[model samples]
Target chain A: AQSVAQPEDQVNVAEGNPLTVKCTYSVSGNPYLFWYVQYPNRGLQFLLKYITGDNLVKGSYGFEAEFNKSQTSFHLKKPSALVSDSALYFCAGGTHTDKLIFGTGTRLQVFP
Target chain B: AAGVIQSPRHLIKEKRETATLKCYPIPRHDTVYWYQQGPGQDPQFLISFYEKMQSDKGSIPDRFSAQQFSDYHSELNMSSLELGDSALYFCASSLVQGANTIYFGEGSWLTVV
Candidate 1:
């Protein structure tokens, strides 16, 4: 079984300020991690994924995540946050496309 | 690019009633997945199919059943609807479900009352 944990229930960031949502994974072997964003009453939107290769993975809507194996973390980041970027962000884990185990989710609130 | 399509984006059903949700996967995609998202919660995997065959299962309830047609479209039949069944149902697809970027539909909002 694979699972991801979101340490924060909510993160507050002002518009134009940088933001981060923390995530950690528990997997037996090589881990495939993904980040998704969901607006109110909407489906999960793919932001980015880390399968293999570079530790820094870029995603949609100016979002990026750094995979730290030793730390067992994949933290979503943005150099500058926008009000529109506010949403519920999720961190998911899988080995190779198996059913992904998702974290509880972290709500990102960007105030203008 | 054609993405995963789901029918009846919003549905309202009474308790004990039955509802069916449809999903049209992206063209040439061989795998389809169903997920349920509760309010303010993460999406939970229900089931998945590959080449019209059941490939994986998750926390799907016995009252719900799903199948993929020969054309690769899929249907999810949920019976005996309960208040707990009210949630956003998402249908997602990928080429073959392995390390592929799985794309999700806008989602079907099912309201049980």
Candidate 2:
């Protein structure tokens, strides 16, 4: 079975500073990795995905993720943080079984 | 065009009562999925339907059931609700079952007393 792990329960960052949210996965064959952001009382919004192309995949809201096959990691990153970026983030893996396995999720807090 | 839509944004139910949540998928989408989200946790897959047929279910109790109708809509029903069942439920739809992006609705908040 495919699964994902998010080591951090929460991440605190200052506005204008770089931020990173870590994620790792285990899957059979190739893995389709995705990142999503969720605000309070809202459903998840798609951020980015890594299917097979470049190691670094860019996504919405000036966010990007680096897919590292050796580390089994796909860490979401941003050059600078904003107070608006505070939210809960989730990492997921897509398998050939047509199901998505998600990590426990990480909450981000950006302070000005 | 509007994204996936879920009805009855908030619900409060008593134990042993039944609750039903509705969803309207995007036009032409063929697959619908249901997920449960607890406080401070990622959404957990509950069930998936494609072409109006049940496809996959995650680690959930039998009290949780779902159905897809005509590929454009779906419903999640819970019987004999428990306190542990209180959480936000989200409905999502994808163009296909495999290797496709799934879009989600705002979600419905279910509170069991």
Candidate 3:
């Protein structure tokens, strides 16, 4: 079974400050981790993925995530948060069944 | 880069009525996946197809069926709609054996009345 967990239901950060949305996962085989963002009434947009190799992966919108195998975590990070970054974030782990199991989601709010 | 396309951005249906959603995958992509996201909920995988064949399924109701066509387009048919079925249906496509970074469409909003 493959499952993802976003411990925080919501995260608040000041614009220009750093932001981190935590994610952890459990999978039987090699984990294919991914981060997606969804805005109001919009479909999910892919941020980045950690299939293999590098632990630190950079994504669109100046966002990145670090895949920690030992910790079973893939936390999304941004050095300088923007108000436009406010949205719903989801972490997912791809399964052997060729489907992705997603976490509940974390709502990020970048305060100006 | 061409992205996945989904038809009927918004749909409304009554109970027991049937609804059909269509999806067109990106060019050269051989895999298509369907997911349902309820209000205030994470997206749930419903089904997937590879090369016009069913590859995997998850949590899809019996009343709901989907198929991928020869051209790699797909359709999801839902019968006996219920209020609980109201959600956003998303279609994603990816190249088989490639990076496997599934790209999602804008999604179709289904509201069962």
Each prediction's whole-model lDDT (CA): 0.92, 0.89, 0.94
Model 1: per-residue lDDT, tens digit, A1-112? 6789999999999999999999999987888889989888788889999989999999888889999999999999999999999899999887765767889999999999
**Which model scores highest in lDDT?**
3
lDDT of 1 by residue, B26-86 (tens): 9998999999999878889999998999989999999999999999999999999999999
For model 2 the local lDDT of residue B16 reads 96
- CA deviation > 4 Å runs, candidate 3: A95-97
TM-score of each: 0.96, 0.95, 0.98
lDDT of 3 by residue, A14-47 (tens): 9999999999999878888899999999988999
lDDT of 3 by residue, B1-113 (tens): 88899999999999999999999999989999999999999999999999999999999999999999999999999999999999999999998778888889999999999
**Per-residue error (Å), model 1, residue B31:** 1.2
DockQ of 3: 0.77
| Deviating ranges (above 4 Å) for candidate 2 | B97-99
User: Candidate 1: lDDT of A46?
Assistant: 91
RMSD of 2: 1.5
Docking class of 2: medium
Name the candidate that leads on DockQ: 3
Q: Tell me the DockQ of each model, to 2 decimals.
A: 0.74, 0.70, 0.77
Interface RMSD list for the candidates = 1.2, 1.5, 1.6
Order of quality (TM-score):
3, 1, 2
Please give the lDDT score at residue B106 for candidate 1.
93
* Ranking of all candidate structures by their lDDT, best first: 3, 1, 2
